[model samples]
Target: MPTAPAAEPVPSVPSPLIRAFPTAPPPDGLPAERESTAPAATGPASPGGDAARTAAPAVEDDADAARRAARAPGRREQRYQETRARIVDAAADLFADRGFDAVSVVEIAKRAGVVEKTVFNHFPMKEGLVFDADPPMREALLDAVRKRPSGESVSAAAGSFVVAAVGLLGAPEAAEGVARMARVIRGSRTLQVREREILGELTDSLAGLIAEETRAWPGQVEPWLAAHAVLGLYASLLELARDRVLAGVTGPELSGELRRQGRRGLALLQFGLAGYAKRR
Candidate 1:
């Protein structure tokens, strides 16, 4: 017994349950300080405590896995969106080259370098391909009015939204697209009907938003009236753009014309047209 070695101290591991879900004081009105200062039990852990300790690490691992999975559009979603865009572009080019009715879904799929089934998967109908942007446009328009700045009228917000959109017609590339779209619509009765349907749908949605914002009574017609008037002004602007595009007006001149017309339209809406155009 000449050299006796001292025992090494063992490090204590914290309970997994305590790390995951800290214990709270019992409902018997025990103080948190008393609970915190309580001595550890020397006896075996209760069944519930053992189960919670066993599950804590698994629960934590699952949460971490979920967080990693929640990141934006991985490779699969990116590929899907890219394919959809290609299909839409191919369909548009083909439709513009030869009228909408003349272009087949098969041809569109071929041009996009995808199978016909893929085209059908993206766009259920030919008309759907033509109006691919409708859903997003509708959402954006409604959002513009819904989120307008304080003190701004809904009509003003909507008018501004439409006017801002006219800038798209002024893009150098947009001139050709606008002209082609106008020609395509003129050549196809189906497209004309579709355009009107889209407009009507827009009007109905805007009217509903107006009603909600104004808290209109059950039978009130004011929201519908306001929606119609605002959208009518928008329709007029669209016609103006179509006419200008067909006439080969684009770039600064096209933008200038649209801005002037849009301002005039907004002005007319703000200040009633009761005084102007009367016999002087």
Candidate 2:
């Protein structure tokens, strides 16, 4: 009988929400700041081959050190994310319990088991903890538009992103968290203003992307118009989530409603709004 071969291991994929960005490569031949000003191994070999024996181990040590250095950034990033999640979770809990304005950043830092400066390092503004996930989402949404398949309209690409996002809220835990966040946002005027500002920023960014892709001339309204339509769908979906969550809808019921409404909203954008709400 012949022995069987071992199975190959599978590579791990990153979660969609917390994908890591690429770090810059380390500089060649040791960093100037870390390395000493010692001369290279250019002189002739020493008597008794002393330098040769020592040089081999030194080179080996350098290689080992380089390997460790290469892995350090990944470890650092993991720790950073872990700390950030702790802070955000603490803030969410506190905000849900005592309202957003009632909970101080100091209390959040204490609950998260980190110093105040550490909290500030992860989130420049207190509001940032509530919307920590926004930056990655913005990137993903824009990437969907930029990398849409041939023959796919921009609305379809943006719509797919929103629908998929809504699908993630199908989980009970996610729905609950969203409900909490929505309640917190409703209670705070600052949050409402921030939300509107974020929407405006997203609209501007999408408009700029559309203008670049379509090569629209200066003062072109088409790109801005299209951008507003797409982002308006996004805003509508957000409001739907807030409404459904508050209504005690959870799990599939909440997500299904969102996805269905999202599709219908996208259809409206695709087909134009001329026939909508006309007197009949």
Candidate 3:
């Protein structure tokens, strides 16, 4: 042979997680060790005649860590909810101090001590932050309807629950939160849409529950009509309460008014009570 070409040396890589630990080669997705000493050894110890060198042990991998974190059953959801709550809390502070339109995602992120991407990841839009309605009302309605005495009508059950809720939530302290919410909704068209969307979702869910009571599927008109009829009363009464809240009503006064009006409407609409409380 006239001439032989020289082999190029491969570049060394660094460890992924640990900086200077003498761990073994990383599994896939993890970075490699920097500056290996194996190349410095002389020709594999001359076929092991001098000594047989052992290979390094396997080490922890970044990919394995990621998999473990993702595999946790409820942890990911819990983290997500915590992040959302943080973003909402931050947005509330900014939106209260400066109007909703005045505050930007960057400002919210800065206040929350999170990145801008995190803010958007929790709330798709600013409106979403305002209308993140984790409604206890929904659960209460469902429970009241389901747990009511066998002869009681759904309307009566739901109406009684509403009155109780007003008493519980209509404390003078609760007015500030409700007023803040009303201000945010009134300030933005998008927030109005979000409010409607959340309301519609609750309506549909209630319809499903009502349908269950009637032993009918979702598409049946009986349950849909019943749910809408009940919700209409709720919506009207709720609007009346909202107006009072915005007008500086609070404490037992607002709650008593709500209970009075809510019950009056419900009492009139009880109609036939689904023949549940019929006289034999």
TM-score of each: 0.67, 0.71, 0.65
lDDT of 3 by residue, 91-184 (tens): 7877767767888999989877799999887777776666544454676577767877766666666656555554433567567776676666
Model 2 C-alpha lDDT per residue in residues 1-280, reported as the tens digit of each score:
2221111221211112222211222223332334433444444567857777668667766876887798778767867767777787788778888988999999999998999999999888887876533645677778877876666666666666766665555557666566777788889998788878877777888878878887789999877887788778777777777787788887888767777777777776657633322212
lDDT of each: 0.65, 0.67, 0.60
Cα displacement (angstroms), candidate 2, residue 162, comes to 2.3
Evaluated against the true structure, the overall lDDT of model 1 is 0.65
Q: Which regions of candidate 2 are displaced past 4 Å?
A: 1-70, 273-280
User: How well is each residue in 1-280 modelled by candidate 1, as lDDT tens digits?
Assistant: 1111111221111110001011122234222221123233343567788776676666666665665466434545756767877787787778778988899999999998999999988888778776643544567678877876666566666766666676456656567667777777778898778878888888999989888887788778877876777778777877788789898888889877877777677766656522221222
Q: What residue pairs clash in candidate 2, if any at all?
A: none
Top-TM-score structure, candidate number: 2
